[model samples]
Target: MKEELLFVRHLHVEFQHGGQKEEAVRDVSFDVGCGEIVGVVGESGSGKSTVMCAVLDVLPQDADVSYEQLWIRGGKSSAAMVFQDPSAYLNPTIKVGRQLIETILLHPEPVTEKATQQQKKNSRKRAWEHAEKLLEMTGIRNPEEIMKRYPFELSGGQQQRIVLAIALACRPSLLIADEPTTALDVTVQRQILDRLKRIAEETHTSVLLVSHDLGVVAALAKRILVMKDGEIIETGTAEEIFHEAKEQYTRELVEAARKHGSRSQDKRRISETILFQAEHLSFQYTKFHFLKKKSTEAVQDVSFFLRKGESYGLVGESGSGKTTLARMMTGIIEPSAGQILYLKERWKSLQKGRSKAQCQKIQMVFQNCAQALDPKRTIGEALTEPLEIRGGGMQDVWKTEAAETLFKVGLESEILEKYPGELSGGQRQRIGIARALMLKPELLVLDEPVSALDVTVQEQILQLLERLQREQELTYFFISHDLNVVRRICDRIGVLYNGRLVESGDAEQLYREPWHPYTKELMLSTLTADPKKMRRRRNVPELTSRGGTGSGEENGCPYADRCGYVMECCKKERPELYRFEDREVACFLYSEQHSGKRSKEYRMASQI
Candidate 1:
């Protein structure tokens, strides 16, 4: 039998809010065994994080927490935590190397005051060595260079790895990860999860993983705890929880995770006319330090077209320029090079300078609906503000239209009276959609619209978007890091890496057989709740991803360092988007210049 590392029983927590005591977590109980991983999963506000906080004694002073029995083998100090956002926890001013080394020196044991200078020096040296080793263990290469950079200098994946390294620095018996990959792209999320699994096996650390993503939980956890309304509804093995849950909530969660709406078999025919096009679009951000200017291309020469009533997905990881491309399409930011054609007409003006008619033709639903919708304004005002700005509509008419639009988005007319703060995440998202629809725009640029919502809520929003698209013949330029979500809604998908468009083709076909190395990695990185599929994936070898030292500076293929099929030519010259039947992939393996055995096999596969 496995040894139990941490145990809690009958845990209850409450906080004082608005003159009332609100129960955040109630009657929660669970245990983590040595070298075991346990997952707690539920929607937002279900108190998953609260239970972990209570265990760590990190709740606010106004809160009350208690348990019938609570114990860990090595006490709370022997535990370390990794949160969702690494940036929030890490110091911006300090180098990550120092931060990690500092954590190592402070934990387990600190140097005694009576120790000699040489002893202290030796201890510090050991800590630095351990820090680099931890960084390497988390899949970070060239740890010494990474140590010299601050948190802000690293990519999101790198930053998260640094945080994970810091947490492991103490050699803690227990590691609590709270929605650690919630904001990460699928590939990076896989890397982080892989690192966690490896560390747990190698160090015998117990992990308490908390997340709303059922797929993520299913991917890593041996045992799963289903939480809802501040209580654990069920506890079982991952296979049992995902496939044979007795609780309705657990079943519903599994169903939602599995149910990405398929493209309608009788989908309406998309118009042949191009609604928007970006020709060799490029954007550069110029930064100055000490009176010296340095320019970084956020987007490189790229081209893509969206047809009327079609959904085009731009898929990539964080910092892959998805948002930058979206901004260019929406006129939020003008491209530094190339032309934007809307309805075959050149669009040279920024959003502010665009005519009212142009504004009415394109609308955007921002990623953070909370920030997009003003806290001070009612939902009705938010919906009507666009019309008021565009003019030619009375206030009463605007309000009436707002109500109708709200109903279209599956929201009640009564929602208009509520403030953005009073509404839930799903409600805010619907409100954002309703506001975008007030203009009855021909195109909608959705930037990670459902990335932050629960899986169930994400399904609802995707369905709503599909319904709206079909009903209104609205064209969608959707951008996201989730390839699974994109496959569900997008007709055609483009894969981006380091500011370049590497592949573009039918969404289903791309998903079925991705030609680009990066695209294939993305598909493999996608975690699902299906037990059979996960078992097969577990047998696959870990592939190198496009993150880490020497990966960002490649002048040829951005993925050259990570590509399993990379040839010597890949490091010398960049490949353009070469045509292959109906698909286009930017890799030498599919190009005429390639003559190797692997290239021949890839070419034959492409034709098939």
Candidate 2:
């Protein structure tokens, strides 16, 4: 039999919150073998992450935890954890490379062979070497350059990879990855899973991956444990759990996954009236030093139009200019170049320069409602801020308007009285939507609106957006990395890469028949809920995604370096947006300049 790495039986955890004892985890039991990948799958607050924390012994001091038979081949020191939110875990002031190397020195593994005092003194050099190796192992291409940049300078996906490198620096025997790929894009997500599998196999490390993503859990885990309301409901092999789940909750999760397989069939009736038009839209930011300032384009000569009643998706990995583009559209910032035409008028980009009517025409629902809403203010005050600050109509009507908005967002009138801190994640998000609706805007720019939400909550918000769009005749510039969410709501989709548009077309057609190599990779990276579709034998070759957020500054195809069918011509100059069937793709295979084989590989990549 395979060597048993960890065996935990009857684990329990209770936390103190608001003078109340609440059970966070209850009677959870599971085991992992040497070089095993065991997944704990559940929705948010199901205690999937809490149970893993119990095993790792990283819970807060005030919490209560108990275990009947907790045995690890190696103790707590042998395990390292990667958190869900990279931003929250990493130091904002420190550079990523330095932090990674520091972690290695801080947690040095025991030397098997006895070394001299002089050899021990050379650990700094050895630590740097290990840090570089870990960085490369986690799919960072330009490690030397990336290492110099601070954590805030990097994108969410880049920070996540750096965090992973730091976790693996100690070379722990057991790695507990909790929602490791939650902030990552599809390509980076694939690379992370591949790298983890390799490390587990080559180094004999065991992994306990906890995630709310069923597709991700199915892709990696050999054995599966299902959790609900802090209790382990079912345990089985990947195939068994996905295909033959016995419990009702387990079946519901499996069904959610299976339902996620097909394309979203919702169709919208978009009008010909161009509600929002972005012409030659470009934006750039300057990096400051004492004397020298360098300008880098966050968004470049890109343009798209959103109809009066359409939900348009802006899809890309982190730092692909999705947020920057959304902010520009909402007049949060002025573009250095190009113009925004709203309702056939030249709309001002600067917020202060724009009229109150222009402001009322466009409103945004921010990504993190917790940060967006004022903590001290009640939800009613939060909703009224838009009307109060703008001096819309009269002060007496503000409360009435807030009430109507709350109901419009599908919340009870009582919700307006509570502060944002008192509400749940989903409820806070609804309040955010209500606040946006209070402005009664014709266009809404939603930046990763449903990303931070749980899957069930995400679906509910999507449905709410759908109903609101139809009822209010609202247009949306929906920015998100989740292709499934985009597919469900977006009438059209544009693939953004390195501050530019790579492809633009109908959502369904682009997903089904992608022309650009990067688009193909993004689709390939999207994980579905089926376990049988994933690699089980574990001999799959390591396919590294070189650039997570962008292609390098070389005057060639940004993705050419990582493209499987890269040709010599692809290295010379960047490809322009070429016309493909009802879409624009920045690739040469379809153009007259193309010569080599492309279909078989492209077709295989398109198989959802």
Candidate 3:
């Protein structure tokens, strides 16, 4: 057997919190061989990230770190890390290119031979070139344009790619990616993972990928480490983890991942009465150049309806027009070419004129709670804004209601007096939820509401939402990339791809039998906690080039490029919605000619 690129033997990490010793990492041991991808899987507070931080010597000064043995490549070890939150890790004020170039220059290789000095200089130049290539490889459209931009100017996905590019600039033998793709959309995530895999293969670099996502780990990692509460509970290959897990926690994690793609519910009749409808919903943004002009169609010809007391979910990868559609639903951005009808009353008509009561009927909770609330304002003020805007004059009564709402979200009333900055991410999210509840809206649009939360907090929020829906008879339009949360809360789900609804059906039915390829891929990509089951699953195939049209162009099947069962008509003619038992799928595989002929092919592909 080849020598491992890196090894960790009996590592222990701790911290002194309030003068008491707290073990963050306990007797953890792992190895990353040359060109190997080792994944660390765990929920929040599992100390997975803490182990990586300890290895990098990036932990806080007060952190206590001990290790029996630590070794790396070439009999000398140096490593670099890419953090989970790019916004917190990257310098917001500096140009990304400059920062990357500076990082490369700062890490000069030890020159031995006289001729090696010139070789090292050449390596530095190659490193800079590789940095630009890395950005492009990671799916950033224009590398030069992105490099010129600062970290804050880029989107979350773009920032993550930039950080990844910088981490690779040093040409380190071992790289640590800490939940690097957690904030990315599914498509972007697929692209990013593919790039990392390719880089690792080409450079023979080892990777320690820490993530809560099981699907990501399955796709990229060969060996798996399952952590719970700062301890390694299980270790195995991907197939063993996914298929034959022995631990109860491992089984629960597998079940969660398996459940993500399934929607099992007791048969509940869905009424035909549509409470809210969006007709020809279209939105666009203008792009101004010196002399050229461009208009980006974010949401085009999108139409959907929400029934009273029904939970509807919108699912899609990043930039697939999920958030844009959510914004239109909440009246934050008016549709450029469509009408939003609330019980036969158009939003345009309401915009021209409407009562406060009518306006208060719709409310939204955004993805980022920290940015949603005013930093200077206390939580009390933030929660009461909607009430004040609607002229709900009973301030004292609403204040009491606000406290109750906070309490419902597992928060104390004392949190009301605290500023947004003073609250934790989870607390701020609850405050956002509290503010939305205060409006007493008939339809609540939750846009990726629980994506930023940890699993435990997410469970609490899910239960809270379910309870509120039952008690208040609230209709929800829940938007999320997390299929597990969607399965747990949504009654019906609408799968969107590049601004079009490719699939929609009862959540349970859809999960059990996902007809659309995109939907299936999304389900397959989600990770579970089980070590044995995860190991049993095969590696996800790399996304193939979809050589047909631009993203915004109208298509029969938006996923035709990535779909494994593509036909001739899939390229030229777009597939229309075809009924599949209880769901609707837009794919030629379900079309007339290939429907029966493709059944075998579909079964074979489904095994993936």
> How big is the RMSD of model 1?
2.9
The lDDT of each candidate is 0.86, 0.82, 0.77
The 10-residue segment of model 1 with minimum total lDDT is 540-549
Candidate 1 runs further than 4 Å off: 110-113, 261-266, 351-353, 538-555, 595-604
Superposed on all Cα atoms, the candidates' RMSDs to the truth, in angstroms, are 2.9, 4.0, 5.2
Tens-digit lDDT string for candidate 3 (376-409): 9989888888878777478898788889988877
Number of the top-ranking candidate, with lDDT as the measure: 1
Candidate 3 C-alpha error for residue 375, in Å: 3.7
In angstroms, give how far residue 210 of model 1 lies from its true place: 0.8
TM-score: which is higher, 1 or 2?
1
Tens digits of lDDT, candidate 1, 1-608: 87899989999999999999999998988889988999999999999988888888888999999889998888888898999889999999999888998888888465457998888899989988888899999889789999999999888889989999999987889999999998788888887898888889998889999999987887789899999999999999999998889999899999888875344343766999999999999999999999999988989999999999999999998888999988887778888999989999988656447677887888999888999988999988889899988889689999899999998999889888889999999999999888999998999999999999999999899989988998999999999998878888899999999899999999988889888888888888888877566757852244355433234445668778777787777877788888766688888887665844454345445531
Q: Name the lDDT of candidate 2.
A: 0.82
By lDDT, the candidates rank as: 1, 2, 3
Per-residue lDDT of model 2, residues 1-608, tens digit only: 98888898999999998889999988887788988999998888898887887887878998999889987776888788988888998898988877988899888867747877787778877887888888888777778888889999887667888888888887788889999888577767776787777778877788999888888898889899989999999999999998888999888877765554455565667899998898888998998888899988888788888888998999998877999988888788998999999988988866549888788889998889999988999888888888887874876688888888888888999987889988988999999889998888999899888877766677788778988988888999999887877887888899998888988899888888887777877887877787777664232233434343134446777677667777666777777776645577777665556744556335322321
> What TM-score, over all chains together, does every model reach?
0.94, 0.91, 0.80
Q: Could you tell which candidate, 1 or 2, scores higher by lDDT? A: 1
TM-score winner, 2 or 3: 2
State how far residue 111 of model 2 sits from its true place (Å).
Answer: 5.5
* Model 2, backbone clash pairs (residues 3+ apart or across chains), number: 0
